[model samples]
Target: MQDEGISRARFLAAGLAGAAGALLPAGSAAAKERWGLSYRGVCYEVTDGETAETGWNATRMRTDIRAIKDRLHADSVSVFGDGAGRLKATATEAAERGLHVWLQPRLADRPPHEILDHLAETGRHAERLRRQGARVHLSVGCEFVLFVPGIVPGADAVERIRNLMSGNYDPQQMMRRLTAFIAQAAKVGRSVFHGPLTYGAAEGDEVDWRLFDLVSVNYYSYFQDPARHVRELRKYQRRHKPVVVSEFGSCTYKGAPQKGGMGWDVVDYDKPKPEIKGHLVRSERTQAAYLTGLLDVFEAMGLYAAMTYNFVTPDAPHRRDPRYDLDMAGYSIVKTIWGTENDPTSHWHWQPKEAFHALARHYARPHRRLDPA
Candidate 1:
């Protein structure tokens, strides 16, 4: 029975693709490019103290935002936060510089009513921004797949899957909530978009294609090789959805040992104490290679938009905390606090690694095509 169901779903997807392809012209100009960078909007998780605080000083944060606007020639900026004031301020700043703003508030753990209340508040704020002649985009949550277990535990997996397929609670409920939210916001005159937690090109069971205008996918290359990564994105395009590489960056430092406690070194207490050096410096060339190759794939696939992982970090010193520190070891686009004077080739610095220059030039003059021959 499960095999038959799987085969039916594949047939439906293929039929949908054929119908849509027949309706559209071949190689029509792809969707407009809307590219930007992702980072802590207002809050940064401090490594030394293990506390979340505003990541950048007002002046530096504004400057950093402007730098991204200038460098990427982005059509818009996206920030993650739930506060109306913060979203309004970000929208104003980006609008002043002729950029749109997308907000992805954290709503995964909240109760359904609370989530609705938050979305109502966001809709109100987005409407206000629209009144002020600013473009604002709102997303319900980020990576809701990670929340499925919370909503539907392991014990209820079969029951939950049945309910989801029967249009009882999962996607059907999500669509109803989103439709109500969108209708209310539309009354106040605001345009909206949805950014779901997408893994590769495979749209999860929870995504209702009709709920969103633009399909947003976040890609992180922690476990997959480059070829597999590109193949995943190609599958996503086959669905006839305009795609966005919402988050992408590679870690070069693979937890090795270093001679001196220099640069951004954090001791992982949980690991075996055999001097685990980070992959930061060791991964610069690999990181650059990945970016170059990924960009080529994205362009060839005619992806709508792509945003790199981050822009800047807070002034806090790198310490024992794993999340930011582990990422700092190799994931940064600019060196800022993570790079050492000794390691001029560090992936974190302003000096463009091969990947940095490759992208900068690609975005600057995208008309030139590189022949595989």
Candidate 2:
């Protein structure tokens, strides 16, 4: 699932000073509303389809949504991908199931107009969902500099990333374009969407928080200095808006936690067929420990929400062949399996990985009040 960061209007009061005591853990019941998951059920136009996450089945989506609420016990979900209709359906389903909806419409590598048009449609639908008694927030977009155009070179995110690494592009100019685009997105989104608005930002996006209602960052921390994660988060603190970690997770391989967001770099795309570039040991426990440790960080930080990168990546099916298996590069908590008709009672084709069980246990724990004493 494609997930972004969360803002805590759902739980935040006037300011952090007033909000801090309530949000910090003292062991009552999770403050009861911070856990969330990313649903990558519909990334409309992924380049090369590196991820197999965009398998949209209503039954499966609903089941996954239910699991986020019922099984994983997530308080909310950030919906990613394109197609206004699909976004509406998935978000509505999640909302009706009583999970808060972070309605993020990811129209990747499209013209700016197309992207905005998608946001307009999704915003209207989100507004409708909110009016219909659902807790909904519209994330204008995610990673404009990477996904949207004119910031850097290249047609898709991959090319842009490569181009960015080459240092041929101008950073100041890129930020200028990105910052402006985000402002326009916020303005356009606000016209149709009459609720709290958030933008799913990269760690270094430098987004103007004033344009948004809350701060939502897709932060994947390399496990070098865990305390440094806390310091970086505090930088985003606004007087009232709650800061959230939108996306964070590791690939199911050893030492992935140290690489953070770059964990996916292990894949050898240059090969005729995709495979691990080198000998890498698969360790689900490494991913599990990394994820749980961050959850602890978020919990301790009293964040608005901490949404792991995703629930499942269906395109990247788990294979016994380590060289062929795509799940090793994914951040999904569940490993995708193939089988529908064979299983009479299930619409989903996934097995719980170590991270899933670990998260379930973490989420199921009692959270204390996030309200001031």
Top candidate on TM-score is 2
In model 2, where is the ten-residue run with the lowest total lDDT? 1-10
Per residue, candidate 2 scores C-alpha lDDT tens digits across 1-373 of 0111211111222233233335334443333344332221111111223323344667667778888788787766888787787788888888888877788888888899888988899899999998898987789989998899888988899889889878978989998899889998999899998888889999877888888776889887763434556566666764356666777778888777667777888888778767886887787877877777666666655667767887887666677788867789888889877453222123337888988888888777766433212
Poorly placed runs, candidate 1 (over 4 Å): 1-57, 131-136, 147-149, 152-206, 221-230, 252-281, 315-330, 336-358, 366-373
Candidate 2 residue 253 C-alpha distance from true site, Å = 0.4
The TM-scores, one per candidate, come to 0.58, 0.83
Number of clashes found in candidate 2: 15
Candidate 2 has a TM-score of: 0.83
Candidate 1 TM-score over all chains jointly: 0.58
Tell me the tens digit of each residue's lDDT in model 1 across 1-373: 3222212222232333343343334564332231222211111111111222323234444665676567654554566544545555555666677665655554434454565565556656655666677655555544443322334332343454455556555555554544454344333222332222222121343345444545566655422233344455554555565666655554434321121112233434466432334433344455545555455445544565566544433332232343434434544455444344222122332333344554555556534222111
Give residue 216's error in model 2 in angstroms. 0.7
